[model samples]
Target: MTEPVRLTDIAELAKVSEATVSRVVNGKAGVAAATRQAVLAAMDQLGYDRPARSRQRNAGLIGLIIPELNNPIFPAFAQVIDRTLTLRGFTSVLCTQSPGAATEDELIEALTERGVDGIVFVSGLHADQTASRDRYTRLITRGLPVVFVNGYAPDVKAPFFSDDDAAAVQLAIAHLRELGHERIGLAVGPSRFVPSRRKAEEFRRLMAPVAGEAEVERLLVNSLYSVEGGHSAASFLLDEGCTAMVCGSDLMALGAIRGARKRGLSVPRDFSVIGYDDSPLIAFTDPPLTTIQQQVSSIAAAAVRALLDEIAGLPVPSTEYLFQPELIVRGSTAACPSS
Candidate 1:
């Protein structure tokens, strides 16, 4: 007894190409698990027979490795990278690194073992000039198309995308200077990272003349990119008699505000704080943080496009593509207390 079945029925049921269904039904390869499931669902809905021994496709998966998903900034970037990859007909495998967990090298090796088409790294070891570059060179030797985001190693042969940290600090300093914040302070991450070094250098240059020698020393504080780091850095700034603070991240800025309140100080009154990376939900925080907004979509899209272009044998620009951040004025920052 022959059952009633047609390609159109299978295609409509699976919501996929008749070719995909045919590939699955004929025990062929190159179909994704999720896609294969969709086809199977469609067949079941249409009461079609099951395939004998269908397997999933492993060819189109791309690896996206990022550092520390706890920060909103990293997650925001990851989301964009994932969406952009999916739109390009590639399945994304997001690998996030945490303390004592999977290391970047291990993640890369695993992804490669799984036969990823390419790799995208965000805020990885490339940002640290002190870190070894042999891993990157080895990947290059292995003929893998790797793209870097928010980290640029000049010697590494790959397309890179990042925010202009110097310009970001300059923008923040300019705004504070305009507001008559003569005794301004800075709270940023460690200087080992390229972005932090650029920010610190630009800050010193800008503060050298505008602020006095004692004030300049008081104005700079290095710490982690967290709320607690911000709290401690702001405490130092306050102890040094700083009236305003410029932080490296929105999370740090929030911490600065907390530090001030702990001492019975009011933001924009007793202390003014500015933050970087105007990530999602930052505006909804108490007093609404004034921050520098990273061009996430543009940067993410550019990185993916560069990697895909390289994968397709197209010429990718070897230079770093730096996107400038915009300063968003919000309630967290205001006129200096003297004004």
Candidate 2:
């Protein structure tokens, strides 16, 4: 092993006293568990080799594949999953993909080669109706333990965990309607994704009682699940004279707010906006967003538990587990404005 890193460096990095760092390094008693953990984390962060006594044998490697980290919700899920997995004695290797980065297939192949004990997929290709299901089938054939989040593939034999997309839309619609808003529009991602399709279908069904089915389509806008996408969709909804809007993600809701402000409209006054996934810091946004809160921790824990069961050679039936979402009222929604 290389020369031991300086105690002062570890102490400064961990924000602990030098004596505390020395005690942790020397494996001395009397240190709080949390403090020891903090010192060790600091050592790891500082590129220091842990003393033999402080080293832990990893339970196993698990792969966590996600679409992208640009959105806060993905990171939120990652944090919870990572912490839970670590607490369970497993180490997680997170792989994130974007337009041109490593694709899901590439990451899967790499993880498989590395002999990962299990894999977790969040909002992956399994959620896209148009994507081929053969990839997941091959994994099942190889007897690899896998868990899917936020998407479902009937043909893929794996445990699936998802937030109730339909219920979320219903809640958003009901909240807006209770506020006396009739012309509420839905802004969501493309219909190719299962969650987006569910939201769109439910939105149409719920609004049919208010406006005819034909007008429902007019109020629905399918676009990317990004801020720019939300902004563009909100612009179109505004053109349709929508007084309230529901978005698929918090990023989109912020984008809608931006689009409204661009037109000199104030939120919850001239227009009301509701978003899905009450991501971190969303409550601190201007006119704090009213949104649907996904049970992220619960879903993550269930996904980990299901995967662990499969890894232990226990029979885990492949099925969809839906967690209910709740509507959190904030400054972004209010009674509909009177003409």
Candidate 3:
């Protein structure tokens, strides 16, 4: 037999009074929905199974599809989303994919077969400009509640959550310019992804005032979203007299540091780098990385609210919700060389 649940434990975990926990646990009618959700989330966090009487209160299961867990940012999004769903009495089913692993289509098929009430996709196929949008179109036609994150497709009739990619590039440029770095360059992901395209276009637009439009293209390098990709892009830009570089991710920034070291140069002394995605451990790196912070918590909350509205048969507007990004300055960047 399972151990009896304790009201004090739930109260402490939920940061609420024992009386409130008592009301929620006993299924009393006066407990506020917000308080009840906090209690449920606390119970889930503590691995306490709900009382048998409360089994019927579960909202439903939600499928959360992500590109991969290799990047710290993806897991960061997953943790907040899972916690939010549990608080609202919904279960989260996480699906991850890699280059050679289960394709996105396979994951979607499995999720649909399992009768998931709704789906939340993060950096899925919808972000690929070259990919067919028919998959998302079919889901909309079937009336399934879905939300996309970090990617936007005009043809997909679902709510989209994305960080302002163009603004991020602009922020980096402005900061580097203030540091007297005239030969600034960008190292971003492949051109096929929506974010990559936006960053590139914005970089060119801003650089055109400094360098002609044709010369701006020479300072931009398209590569993978990895450390090696950053190294390669940085190497090319450095050879072209670039004293500072902006990378698509922190991993790339670290790689760019390595590239600078290989050429017998010290970071912030001979070169400076800025990265995107202020992930959890990024601040603790060798030289705490300067990065663009995506408002993951707010975006995840908004995405969940939209999905819940759709699930509840409420009128949810199909529009793109853009979250502003903040640029975090740290030790990895410095004034340009005076040589």
Best by lDDT: 2
262-328 in candidate 3: lDDT tens per residue?
A: 9999988889999999988999987889899999999998899899889999988777888999999
lDDT of 2: 0.92
TM-score to true structure, per model: 0.83, 0.87, 0.91
Worst 10 residues of 1 by lDDT: 50-59
Q: Write the per-residue lDDT of candidate 1 for residues 1-339, one digit (tens) a residue.
A: 976988788897677889988887776767775676677667778877775565333338889999887799999999888767765668899999888999889999999999998999999989988999988889988999999998789899888999999999999999988888888889989888888888888898999898755567667888998999999999999998888889999999999999999999998777889999998999998888989889999999999989889889898877899899999999887788887
Name the candidate that leads on TM-score.
3
Error of 3 at 41 (Å): 5.8
lDDT of each: 0.87, 0.92, 0.90
Winner on lDDT between 2 and 3 is: 2
Q: What CA root-mean-square deviation does each model show from the true structure?
A: 6.6, 4.4, 2.7
**Between candidates 1 and 3, the TM-score winner:** 3
- Backbone clash numbers for all candidates listed: 2, 0, 0
Candidate 2 residue spans exceeding 4 A from truth: 1-50
Please give the TM-score that candidate 2 achieves against the real structure.
Answer: 0.87
